[model samples]
Target: MSTQNYLVISALGKDRPGIVDELSKAILNIGCNIADSRMTVLGGEFAILLMVEGNWNTLGKLEEAIPALEQQLDLTIIVKRTEARDSTARALPYVVDVVSLDHPGIVHQLANFFSQRKINIEDMATTSYAAPHTGTVMFSVHMTVGIPADLHIATLRDDFMEFCDTINLDAIIEPAQR
Candidate 1:
């Protein structure tokens, strides 16, 4: 079997219609596969992170084509070579959900909590919005964390709950659904 080469591509530009179509079409035309991707619009900017896979030649072609792509799409593009994730380090995936009155440092605090415990935060998303009735600003966070298999779940949950309480945040830690 042939080995696959991977490239991580990130692009940012003014948001508009057809950006995804054009970008994706270009990748396809270059004979590369989009293994995984995240796309979003933040304020006025369209941002994308893509993991592309192909044989050596195709990936080289994609890299060579990037400057023109950036010019055509009016985007800032960055590309980096990467390999597949190591699967030997096993862990249990847990979902952490938090909501509280909007305040600064929530993300930092959460990051600290996990960091102190040596847990890996695999993914996270946070948003703030006004409450329905009072229009009070509220912030919410959803995170996927990798808890080392050897860690005790019950103890971790207790500690997480207590930590959240101390910070005036409502939170839950549960096994992630497969």
Candidate 2:
């Protein structure tokens, strides 16, 4: 039986076409599988995060080839081995949406509030754009948070709404469908 080894790979470089193709070809050549990944363009840079799976020999081959790829692509690459963890099936998932006039401190304050309450943010994305007609800069955030089973959902919702009100943000909280 082949022993499964997991590798977490992260890379960042100037945004350009063919980066994914090149990296993917390299990974495939080494016989590793791209199990999960997230890639996005942030400003002028392309950020890549991937979880790859293979046996020891394939993983070693990929490791040896990484330096040449990094040099060729002008990328900063980091690779790490990670142990798998059990999924949090017991945690309740909630979608939190917030929108307000663009300003600093909104994200920090929101993160702080959740952190203080021991909430876990699973995924979050934020964007800024000009509002229609008014042309005022507006910020919007969508996040998936994990609420522990012991927490009271109604109480949490009430407190979150009140906090948003105090900060002049329009917000909504609802269950995230699986």
Candidate 3:
């Protein structure tokens, strides 16, 4: 593995089809390899987040390309070099995926559960889906959590399961390797 630096880029604006095509083309034109990315429509708006890797000195290439990209797409772009990617890598991270029928208080219920247990949430994405015409709704959440090695996984899972049953939700926990 290369220990070279990279950049984390993110952007958000009104939802429009083909935003991905435009952004990807821009990054490629500047000669950066995208290492990882997530682009989705969130609340009537399109949002894009990406990790780009290239020689550390080529950052100027990105800066120059962003302004024209923003003007062409009418979207805001934020980019930051990942010079300290491992600064917080001392602890292992675990991912918890939760899915349940749409209902009030689902997010708060699950988020509060983690808060009370002192779990660190690294990243989370929650979205609600509506069944066409029928109007039925469902909610799904994918969250990456950081659990210290000393934490007991089984006990934590059992505790969550107890309430998951009453809420009609399913939860799964898995370790994410560095």
Candidate 4:
């Protein structure tokens, strides 16, 4: 019987063409499958976080191959064994949208509010752009938050709205359609 070995791998380095090509080639050479991943350019650097699965021998080969790729590509790489998790959606999902005039600490304050309330932010993205015609700098955040089954929905919504009002942000919380 052959059981799969799962790994969580992270790579970060100066952004350039061929980073994904080279890194993925290396993983493929060892017969590993890239199961789930997130790749993005952060400032001048490229960041990658991926989960891979393979058999024992292939995974061992991958361990030996990573260091060479690090040197050749000028990358910082980290790998760790991870237990496989079910990807099926669980818990109630809600979408939180916020818009406000550009200002410091907006993300931090919102994150703090969720953290204090034990809310899980499953995914989030933020962007800054100039409002049309007005030329006012505006910041916007879109996030998917997972609300635990036991939490009272109305109370959370009320509290979140109150906090947003205090901070002068236009915000909305609604159920995320699956």
Model 2 lDDT tens row, 1-178: 7678888999999999999999998899899999989899999999999989999889888888889989988999999987454585578899999999999999998999899999989888899999999999999999999988899999999999999999999999999998
**Cα lDDT of model 3 by residue, 1-178, tens digit:** 6555689998999998888887888878777778888888877998888998877656568877888889999899998877645555555588888887798898899889888888878789898888678868878898898766677888987887887888889888788756
How far does residue 133 in candidate 4 sit from its true spot (Å)?
Answer: 2.7
Ranking of models by lDDT: 1, 2, 4, 3
lDDT tens readout by residue for model 1, 39-115:
99988999999999999999999999999999999999999999987798889999999999999999999999999
TM-score of each: 0.97, 0.91, 0.75, 0.86
Global lDDT for candidate 2?
A: 0.92
When 1 and 3 are scored with lDDT, the better candidate is: 1
| Model 2 regions lying over 4 Å from their true place | 1-3
Evaluate residue 22 in candidate 3 and report its C-alpha lDDT on the 0 to 100 scale.
Answer: 79
- Candidate 3 vs candidate 4: the TM-score winner is 4
Q: Summarize candidate 4's per-residue lDDT along 106-153 as a digit string, tens digits.
A: 999999999898888888889999999999999999999988778899
Return the lDDT, model 2, position 57: 87
* Full-model lDDT for every candidate: 0.96, 0.92, 0.81, 0.91
- For all predictions, the C-alpha RMSD in Å is 0.8, 1.7, 3.6, 2.3
TM-score of 4: 0.86
161: Cα error in model 3, Å:
1.4
